[model samples]
Structure formats: structure tokens, C-alpha cells
Target: MRKWLVSVLLLCALPGLSGVCHGAGFKVSEQGAKAMGMGNAFAAQADDASALYFNPAGIAFLPGIQVSLGALGILVPQTDFHGTTPLSGTPPLDTGTAVVTEHSRRDIVIAPTLYASYALENLPLSFGLGVNATYPLSKSWDDSSVFRNQVQIASIKPINFQPTVAYRVDALNLGVAAGIDITYAMVSLQKSLYSPVIDPTAPAPPFGAYEVGSLGLNGTAIYMGYNLGLLWKPRRDLSFGLAYRSKITLDITGDANFLATTPTGMGAIGLSDSALFPYTRAHASSSASTSITLPDTLDLAIAWRPTDRITLEFDATRTGWSSFEKLEFHFDSPQFAAFNNQPDPRKWRDVWSYKFGAQYVVNPRLALRAGYSFDESPVPDQTVDPLLPDADRHSFSVGTGIGTTLGSVDLAYMWVHFVDRAVHNQEMTTLRGSNGVFKSDAYLLAANLNLKF
Candidate 1:
């Protein structure tokens, strides 16, 4: 039977997406390039095709059919860890030795989106559609690192297809949208499974260590969710807006495989044993499944336009992170039951955030934007680990708009800095590869094209 005590612990790493969820808990806030450039404050002033995601209700005010295509590129985070905990057990090769390391991921992740909007002249109603990677993250690490058991590699990518409808009242615009998300998650990890080495000529109580191969988990799931929005224009220059996105329950199912070397790396060192996990070399595989919830959110925003050249915005967002309480995985085969078959607790609390932004129109063809945001972290220090590391954050952003002959283009860049997080948990004293101070910073670059037909 597989003893899942170990397996239960690693599932927490499965929801792992790189920096996609930065300030927020595992959710992407920037949907459209224009909204991103404006510090994601487009809820009340959603005048473009991207309104499909920012606020569908804005579609009712559009003049004709609109289409937009956009893409954002993110540089891998420079996350470094300084191990402050020490292992007090015997060591054959210092398997749990504390090592200071720099950022391991050296890849660039790209996020893309496509949107369309339509307003019927006689119906006073509008319809919109959007296609985008709602949550995008990726990372890779080396197996030889001392932190291998924590996380070697991970990737979480979720694509969303949303369709929306909106109705217009004299001063109020009401809208609702439905979405289908296809999420793909994968993880690779390496750790030592102690197989005691015995020697006849040595001490009565043998204390040498032999190592096995790495364990791997990969999964994919499709889920459903929805969003609602409302926009009210009290004056020609001022507007108020509210938006809500429902939480998603993802049922992840996939295969669990083992990756290791044969002939026992220990056998080459003269410690040939009768207890080397079967005869020569063995690699096991099994089926695994789990359930995870994506948090729900509520956003309130205000936008003010003064003198037609300057626009200012403020927003508040609350995320229901309490939905995430634990990480549990079930195995189809008894083989996994022998290694792992348990649940891990993660009592995350809800969080709130504030954002402010400004847009200045330099001319009819050019505009400039800047914004700032402060977001609280939902992951507590006691639960912080390499697999799921988090901390509060402050972000600064800048962007611009350019009008073209056939359409308009929006470009935005954001710099996110995570407040340094220090952890001192029970695992730090008990687990070999646990405990440390984590630091991270990220960059986002996006561009989009709007077409009117």
C-alpha cells in the first residue's frame, strides 16, 4: 500500500503557478492590455472591446462591432531563498544540507487574449466574447539542488472562453457573463527515500543511507465559472461600477509516474544491498485525482473624467480565499497508498486590495497612463513553503495608447515587488528541505490591437 503522508504534503505544490497570481491568491487580475495599462481600473470607463472582461455592461454604449487581440509577456521571477534551518540527523552525503541559491527559472511566459463586442442599434442591448489565459504561470529547477523535495518544476495554465450579454437603462448598465475554463497543471519533484544500508563489519546499528529516484505528478481538468457587472454614469464625467466573479471548483485527474535511475546509484559505490526496493531497479506509476477551488471576487470602482483630457480612477477588490482549506489527493492504485494517501491543511484567509490610476490625453492620437496598487497576502507564514510561497505586494505600472488608421493599440508594463517573507514553522525543525526567507520581483509587458468594422 502507498503511504500518502508524503504524497498529501506535495499536492499543495500542484496549484503552483509562477507569478500569475502575484498579489492575488492564484488569480490573474489583468485581463486586457488597456485595462492593465490603466492599473486594471477600467471597470467604470470600459469603452473598448475588452469591456467583455472588465465590464460587459460597457458594451451597450459602443457604436458598432469591435474586435481586439492582445498578448502579454512575463519575465521569469528572480526568486532566491536563504536557508536558515539546520538538519540534526545523520548524513551519508549531506542530502539535506542547506544551500543558498539564486533564481532557478530562466524562461519567459506569454499570455494572450482575443475579444469581440457588438451593440444592436435598435435593441439597446450588447453582446461580447473573450478568449484568454485567465491564469498563467511556469517555472523549472534543477534536481541536484538541496531544495529538490520542495519543488523542481511546476506549470499552471488556465484558458477561459467567456460570452456575455448586457442591457441598458437610462443611466444604469447591467451585464452578466459565463465562462468555461480549461486548466492544465503539472509538477516534478525529487527527494530522498531512505533505504537503510547494512554492513556486516560495521557497527551493530547500521546508519548509512541509500537513495531512490524522483516522483512526478501531472494533471488536467476543465471547469465552469461566471461573472457579473454593473456600471452607472451619474454625471458626464463621473461613473461608478461593481463586478463579481464566481469561484471555480476544479476536478483534476491524471497520472502519477516515477523517474529514477536503475542499478541503484548506491550499488556502484560498493553498498550492494538485499533491501534496495525490489531486485535491481523499479519505477512505479499510478492514477491520481484531486479537487481545488479558485477563489471568488468582488470589485468596486470609481472613474472620473475632468476637462476631457485627464481621467482618474480608484478601485477596491475583496477575494474569498477561505474556500481553499486543504489539499487532498486520491489514488486509483494501492501502490500509491503505500507512499501517500492523506490530506494537507491550508487555512487561508480572505484578502482585500486597493488600486489607483490616472490617464492623461496628450492628443486625440496619444494618451499616457500610470497606476499603483497594494495587495495583502492570503497565505499565512506557517504554511509558506517553496511549493506555494506568498507575501504581500506593492505594484507600480505605466502604459500608453496609440490611435491607428484602422484601430487603436494599447501597451502597458508593470513591476511587481513582493515584500520579503520569512518563515519559521514546525517543518523547519523536522523536515530536511524546509524553512527559509523568500524574496521575489516580477515584470509584465502587454500590447493589444482594437479593430472597428
Candidate 2:
């Protein structure tokens, strides 16, 4: 039973590709305008109680209690392909030919996060806590008439929650945190290129007459990890901050079901016996388990506040993508091989992200913000598939805030431009695999709010 459970969990980490939907970076740094201006390098400075996540020790200066809430919207991202294909012995023709066309459009995702903090009043030491999320993975592709009769194979929709704590001294701060990493996974795919022996002269199967299914699963296991940071102020005008976030491994488990399908008398339930057909119903009914591991990551940052009204920040991050080189699955039932050994094309590489930002106070009650960042892609060119269209990107952002006798509030917006990425990606099949060269453009718009009492 334990081994079976392991197999189910591994299935969760199926393929590591980040298209506009899956490959995009997580931008959860919607904190105070002061933090956003400096590109969120609070790990070492811990300017506010929220700095605990950035640097627990920074919380040493935070007075009383503070709470915050914010909303972020990732605008409609866009990615498409335009290129040529070598047409050889393919359907309705002979060998030695080339074809060219465009890739399909992808969907948009909107996600949000919330946080709160409290500081110890009359103690030499201070403590604080917060909650947020990270983008694990996603995929979406729909181009069936092309080579390999490609069908969208998307394993998108994963969300994570993080809770943490910190401690502080005069000019230096340090902190650590741990929590449950819950992930909801859903995978959809199709095998629509079966050359049935049906009499071509007799009749053609209705265009929509194909087999399909939706697999929904939940992995409810507690994954644990921690983070560390330091902040120092050598002088009034000179200060520095640094932080390290540990890695986490999430083992998820849930049921896989067939949401919809067109039956063709063939299997136990009179369904067509096609290769790509996911025996999810059979696997679920028979207690077939599916699972996978979420990788770990590291973040380093720095901030410089020249004046009480002006500040600057920068950061660099690395994700444990190397931990996802390959995937393997096992079930207590025979259906395991069909689902495990099957083609799950994914070989993701580690990635690094850099951020630089600035904030200016226009007046005592209002402030403004702006910044830029460069993020690298982990997807290799050789394995670049249409489903997981990932590429390097550049982001530009701006925002503002308001202060009152009671507390303060902040908001920000960003625009991300993915560098022009053009590559040849192949979709593999049992008999053979066909390649698709893709190109795309994407954008993101985000906002955040903060409060203290």
C-alpha cells in the first residue's frame, strides 16, 4: 500500500513545462509601497513586520500589530506558433514534403494572496508571521489537425500556501518558517489520430465522434520547508538585507475521474481501445493511485534606502527544477504501466530571476512606485512542446500608496514582455513524433494592498 501511494504521488509531477499559463513566474511581492519600490528585498532590512518572510530578525523593530490584504490579476497572456513542417509520408500524401502553420491561443489565469502579522510589545525580542502562495506549474495546448494529430495535454492548476515567523535585534534581523503545501492537480489529454479500418467509401466518422476524459485528483499531504534572512544598517544612509528560502516536497493524492466521453464499443464498458485513452475511471474505481513531488527554491535579495522618501531594491531567485528530471509511477493494479511508462515528455532545467525597483514619496500622505525584472526560462529548446511554451521574460511595473494617522494602504501594476522565443518542439506518438515550431507574446497586470493597526 505504501509503494502504491508513492507511485500515485510521483504522477503529480508528470511534466515540468511553463507556457504562458504554466511557465510564468509567481509575483506575490504586493506589500507596502516602500517594499515594492525596493523590489521586495526586505529579507535583510525587515522594515515592517511583513519583513519576517523577507527576514524574521527585521521584525525586531515592528511596533504593536499589523495586518494586510491584497488582490492581483494576471492579464490575458498570449503565445502562438508560426513556422514550416517537413511533409513526408504523412496522411493523404506521399513522403518528402514540408508544411507551415501557426500555434493555438492559450488561456489566462487570475490568482490572489493574503497575509497578516503581530509583534511582541514589551520584549527584547520580536516575533512575526504571514501567509502567501507560489506558482508550481501549468500547461495548455489545442491543435489536433496538425502532425501527430496533436491533442491538448494540459496539467495546469496548482496552488500553494506558506506560513512563516521571525526575530529581530537593533540593526539586524533573522527569521525562519514552515507550513503545509497543498496542491490541486487536473490533467486533460486526447488520442484522436487512430486510423480506423472503417470503409472510407462507406462513411466517415463524425468529426466530433472521438473519445475524451478529464482526470481530477487531490494530493492532501503536509510538505514542510523553511527560510532564513539577515538585515544590517552600517550607517543612517547605508543598509543591506539578504535571505534564503529552503525547498519543499509536496506529495499529493486524490481520485481521477472521466468527466465526459464518447463511447465506442470496444473495452469493458464498450469504449474504444485507443492508446492515449486514460483509464482513469478504471484506475480510480480499482483504487489506482496518482501522485508527484513539488520542488524546492532559493531567493536572495538586497535593498538600499537613501532617504525616508526614496528607496531602491533588487533580488535573485533559483528554483529546484533540476529535481524534476524524470517521472515514474506505480499502482497496486495492472493499469499502472499504461499510465506510467507512457510518454510524459518533460526535462526541466533550473532557472534564475532578477528584480530591480524604486519608490518615491510625493507627499506625506501619498507615495509612488516603479521597477523592472528579468526572468529566465528553464525549458530546453530540444524538448520545447506547444503545450508548455516557456521563454525568458522582462517585466516593468508601477504603483502608489497612502498613509493616515490610523495606518496605510498601497497598490501596484506591472507589465511583462516575454522575449521573442522561437523553437522547434516535437509531439511524440507511438509510431513516430512530429515537431512544431512555436512563437509567442504575453503580458501581466497586478495590484496589492497593506494595512496596520
Candidate 3:
């Protein structure tokens, strides 16, 4: 029963609810900014408790017991949206018209993580375990003023669990780990507009309420995936690492609610005479279900220690976002092709990230770290929307750690600046019910804590 509950929560908590970043891309990079600030290139450089998130093998080297925790803040810019209805036939009496609108918020979110491990004194091998959230940030928007033609989306959060093991041989070491991921997600979409055609046969004044739809939709499901990582210490001062996270398939099933006004109901509600325009004369609800694919990822990293007081590291990673090209759903009857026959053209060409960082040892009990990285956006320009407002980004980060006889404490801050991106896809927006060209910008902050015994 707990597993079933977990499964349901996983679907409802994951997916990012079309929260932007090109589909569900934002959910892909939710690690604390300290890791992100370091370019997420710590696989080989895993020495601290946080290493549990990237490579569980690193935990084997930990002596005694240790723990770590922290949080991060993130912001993404909004995209421009525009839509137009091509007029083709005869002209009819019209009472109202539809216009375009937009909205972008600089909202920030905080993410936290925890890690623990123990080393055996009598054995040549070491074993460890940990639980932490990798994907940990999200955003939302619902402004009627700017998104008149666009679908309003709200609430997206996805979390996960990781466990691992490691061993050492002379001067070299190796390790492996796996992940048990859980997620949950919910969404609300709405589109409203005015049209200037009123039928004399139609009940009252302005032709009734022709506008609302899908006030809310929620889905919950459970998925399974794994993680593997490798670490090698070529010399006392040099270490290298590699890791991979498998993809997850989400099967969402749930209920939906919709609102609409028609000739029969509008006249009775006294709204038939309120406006002059085109309107929908029906409101209803239905069952909703969908299947979506999350992507997989691979990372390679290196760490170097030229002196007792300094360490330098670098990392590179690839994400299989291209695997997520379309979302399909099953219904009780004929399926509503909400997205049209548009095969997800998101050829999301694979992307790569590069990071460089350095940690300074001020003393046996103190350390400071700093890093820089460049990331590429996977969303093609034509499909960018509120569902995923992704763009190429630049990230910077800094942090410090204090050691104690029982454990250690770590703190970090990261700043991500999203370049302004403009979206120009009339057909794409129409499929998703959006108004015009879209544009936006964003930022983020983060923190973490670690303990050892």
C-alpha cells in the first residue's frame, strides 16, 4: 500500500506541469545550486557527503559517519507568445474580438539534500547508503492580464532517492550506485477570448459565455529507474569519475474539470446580454490520462589536487531530452487529439555542459569553493512556450565548509542568469492555446548542510 501511495505521489509530484524549460526540461536540473554552481561535475571529485547525489562509490572512502544538507534558489525568464486567427470566409455580425497577452515572474525556489555513510575498520572494502533529492526546483504563472490566449499553468515539483557503495584497491578506488525516483504533478489550463458573432436564434444579449475550459487536471503515478557511477584515483592527488541515470516512463491517470457558458445556460444566468462576441456555449468535465517519458543522463568529471590547500575540478555531461518528443493520452472513447497530429519535432539535439571549479583549504577545519559553467538549452525556438521557457544559460557559484570532531557544515550560493529568449511559433502556440510571440528572463539561489561521525 505504501508503494502504491508512493507511485501515485511520484506522478503528481514530477513532470513540472509544463512549468517551462522546453517541456519538462526544468525538472531535469533540480540539484542544489552548489552542485550546479560547480557545473555538476563532481563525480570524480566526490570527497564530501554531498557526493552521494552524483556517485555513491565516493561514500566508501568516508571514515566513520557523516551527513550533509543544503538548499538553492532558481528563476527562469518568461517567453513571448502571439497568435492570430486567419479570416477565410464570409463576414458575420460580430460583438467582440480577441487579443493577445503575456506574464513572467522572477520567483525563486529552495532545494535541500542529506547524505550519511560509515567505514569499516576490519575490512578492505567499504559500504555506505544515502537519500537525497536531485531534481528540486520549479515555477508557475497565472495572470489573466498577459495570458489571454495562452493556457495558464500552475504547480510543478519532482523529487527522488539515491543509494550507493564503494571500494578501494591500493592507490585506486571504484564505486557504483542506484536511484529510486518518485514524483507527483498537477496542472490547470485556461483560454478565454471574445468573438463578435451573435445568433438571433441564440438565447440572450451577447451570445452567452463562450470561453472557459479545463479549469483543473491532476495525474498521479509511480516510475522506476537506476543510477551507476565510477571513480578512480590514479595518484594520491588525482581522481576521475563517471556516472549515469536511467530514464523513467510516467503513466498518469486522473480526473479533470472544465467550465464553459452556452445559449441555454448563459440566458438563465443573466449573462446573455452582458457582452457582444464569439463564445462557447458549453461547459463539462471528463476523465484524463496520459503517458510521458523523462530523459536519461551521463556525466564525466575530473579532480586534481596540486597542493594540500587547493583542489581543482572539471565536468562534462549529456542529457537525452530528445527522447521526449510527444505526450499521448488514452480516454474512455475516441481520444481527443489535444496536441494535433504534430509529431513532437523536438529533435532536442543532445546538449553538453562544461564546468570548472576550485576549492581552497584555509585550514584543517575550514574550506572555500568557487566555480563557473555554461549550459545549452535543448528547446528549439519554434516550440518555446510557458510550458517550457528554456534558454541557454550562464551559472556562477561559491561556498564554504567548516569541520568539527563529530561532522561538518556546508553552505553555498549560486546565481543563474537566463538569456532573453523569444519564441515565434504561431502553429505551436495555437496547438497549446496561446496568444502571441513569447519572451522572458530568470534567476536562482541555493544552500546545503552536511554532518559526519
Candidate 4:
């Protein structure tokens, strides 16, 4: 039981780890509709209640009480892959002229956000609260696809709560703020496992290539971090903003369940050698734990108001993904020595994204916005895999805001095009497919409602 459990856990742990980390592929940058419309470049022009997310210091410049509620809808079309993966064998075998083509299951995910802030009448102080999903992912491939052993289904849901306090230095036209981020995350993953029997005389590719079982992992974790922001207005037409978010380390505990599938012609071996195939036609569950350090982020931006009715902002963001250099997991039972303390090398690198956005106030009742961004991928080619086929992206967005006596509504639409990725690396060539060309794109629609009193 201990040996079988070790095999099951090691086979699926690394990919499972990737499922939860907020890599460039998993990070959801569109937290507000107004900001989304402006290419997420509103850090310096944080004038709305969404400022709690873009730049908490902007809250100090706001008057009265403000609240904003919104949701981002993501539509991911089928991701296309064409390539070949090695078959299970002592000396890995290839598909041999039988190239494979597969598509990932389409997914539609919705992430919502809420923010509220209050400014003191006499004191240059403001307090705000925000709730949002900064990182959410849902990816799936066909259950019986060639990549099944790598990953079939992966999903992560996380909620972040932030409470912020801002102070304004009216003398210097400067504002600074600090906040705490409390995040709770849940992760689930499923993947197939190949047989351990290495028979070369089998009629098919090989005995080791046969599907023997599947593994499922479910876990939850809670962690904390902090953020700081500064905003300054040197002149009426120009403003500068800076924001920083600290890294968070999550210690996750979960249950690992394994289910075995008896293959034809192997029934005799399973019956005779129960020690080798302990869980054949049976189920086993065990406890598993792991820790991961999410990356930190820094943002700098400049906002210029060329005219009373026009606002333009340019922002650059850097993510310290290098912190995710490796992954380590621990098994609960002491007998599982084979699968303990073995670290998997990720070697991810830090990346940057550049964005520019513009908004034009057409009238007191309407505003038009447009923006564009170039986002870089942190996954090196050596570490890229089917679980998260990350690539650089070009995003385009457009939106509008409508105001009424009661409140205002903001709507935005964005299209993201991933630079098709072609990989010929040795990351997981033997066990998990990694040589392929991946193409993917997504569409996002965001809407936010704002009210002030």
C-alpha cells in the first residue's frame, strides 16, 4: 500500500502544483470594468471606487462614500494542440508517425469584485474594503486524450479580501495607502496514471503504456499578504502612481484518492501479484501536503489629462515569478519515503506587461474608453506543458460608461490572443507530453455598477 501510494502521488504532484500557482497564464488582471476598458492601466488615474484595487491611495482623493460592484466573464474557446508524446516504456517510445491532435474543453468562468470606501470630512484619511478574485482558472482536456496522463481537469478558485487605509498630504499633493490581503484558495485536479509493468512483447505499443488508474487531488489553503501604494500630482495635468503587493506563501493540505482500472490480459498478473497491483479494482485514499510561494507584483504608471474631457494613462507591471523556482511535497505517512522531499525544478522567470489606456468624456452622461496591452509569459519553454500552455499575449479592449441620477454603469469587452507556442523540450517528454504546438485565445466581458452618496 505504501509503495503504490508513493507511485500515485509522485506521478501527479508536479502538474497538480502548477494548477494552483498564479503564473502569467493563471493571473486574472481584469478586476474592474472601467480598468479593463482602459487596458488595466488605471493605476495612476484611480478616480473611481475601483481605486481600492488599482491604487488604494486614490481613495484619499475621493469625496463622500463610494461603492462599486462588478463581474468579469471569461470565454475560453477550445485550445488546439498538435504534436506527439512518448509512450510508456523503459526506453520511452514515440507515437511513430501517428501524430496526435487534441482540443481542450471550452470553459466560461466568471469572477466578481466588490469595493467600498469612505473619506473623512475633516481629516485627510480614507478607509476602504475590497473583495475580488485575482487568480482563477478552469482548464480541461478530453478524458481519453493522449495527454490524459498529464492532466485531464484542473481548477482553482480563490477569494481575496482587502482592508485599506489611505492618508492625504494636502500640502504636497500626495497620497499614500497600505492594505492587507487575506486570501483563501481551493484547488482540484484529475489525471490518469500509466501501468508500471514494463512488457515489450505486448501486441500494443507496450505494457507500460496501458492506462492503469487515475488520481484525484482536492485541497484548500489560506494565506496573507500586504500591499502599498503612492500617488502624487505634481501638476493639474500630470500624475504619477506606484503600487506594490507582497508575496504570499500557502501551505496546502489535501486528500489524494486513487482508482485502478484493470487492463485486459493483466487480470492474471493482478490476481497473482496483489502486492504489485495492490489497488486493482479498488480505491485508496491518503493525506498529502505541500507549500507554494506566490509571486509579488509592482506597478508604476503615469496619467496625463491633456484636456478636461480626456484622460490617458500608461502603466507597466512586473511580477516576481522567479520565486517559484521549484516545488516540494510531503506525504502524511512515514512509510512513503520514496515520495518525500523530492523537489521539482520549475525555473520560472519574472516578467513584465505594458499597457496604455485612454478615456474621453463625451458628456456628463457618457464616456468612451479604449486600451491595449502586451503581456509577457513567465513560463520558460523548458517548463511549459499541457496543463498550462502559457505564451505572450496581445490584448485589445473597448468600453463605455453611462451615468444616471442613481448611479453609473461601466461595460467593457476585451480580446486576448496568445502567441502560438511550439515546444520541443525535455521537461516531461517521457511521462507527460510536452512536445507540441499550442494555440489559444479568450474573450472577456466586464460590467460594473457604481454608486456614490
lDDT against the true structure, per candidate, is 0.67, 0.48, 0.54, 0.80
Clashes of each: 13, 31, 69, 0
Better of 1 and 2 by TM-score: 1
- The candidate 3 region of ten consecutive residues with least summed lDDT is 86-95
Candidate 2, residue 126: Cα displacement in angstroms equals 3.6
* Global lDDT of model 2: 0.48
Which predicted model would earn the best lDDT? 4
Worst 10 residues of 4 by lDDT: 264-273
lDDT of 2 by residue, 252-370 (tens): 44433323222221232223434365443322222333333344556566667788888777777776565555544333444333444433445667787787877678898987878
Error of 2 at 78 (Å): 1.3
Model 1 segments more than 4 A misplaced: 1-23, 85-99, 171-210, 260-279, 338-341, 426-433
TM-score of each model, in listed order = 0.86, 0.73, 0.77, 0.91
| Predicted candidate 1 versus true structure: per-residue lDDT over 232-310, tens digit per residue | 8878899888878788787777877654343333332223424456546556677877777868888888999987999
Residue-level error in angstroms, candidate 2, position 241:
2.2
Of candidate 1, the 10-residue stretch with the lowest lDDT total is: 194-203
C-alpha RMSD between model 1 and the true structure: 4.6
Write candidate 3's Cα lDDT for 1-453 as tens digits.
222221221222223333422212564353543455455557777777766666666776777776666665555444444442211112122211344444554465555555666667776455555544444434445544333323344444545555555565544455554444454433443433222223222423433223322245565555567677677887879988887877777666665543434342232222343435456454444466666666787888888999989888898877778776754334342222231222333456467777788888899888888887777887777656565667777767777767777656666656665666655453311223232454554455556566666
Q: Write candidate 4's Cα lDDT for 14-107 as tens digits.
A: 4665656652657898999999999999999898889988889999898889999999999964689887664322223333234678899999
lDDT of 4 at 205: 38
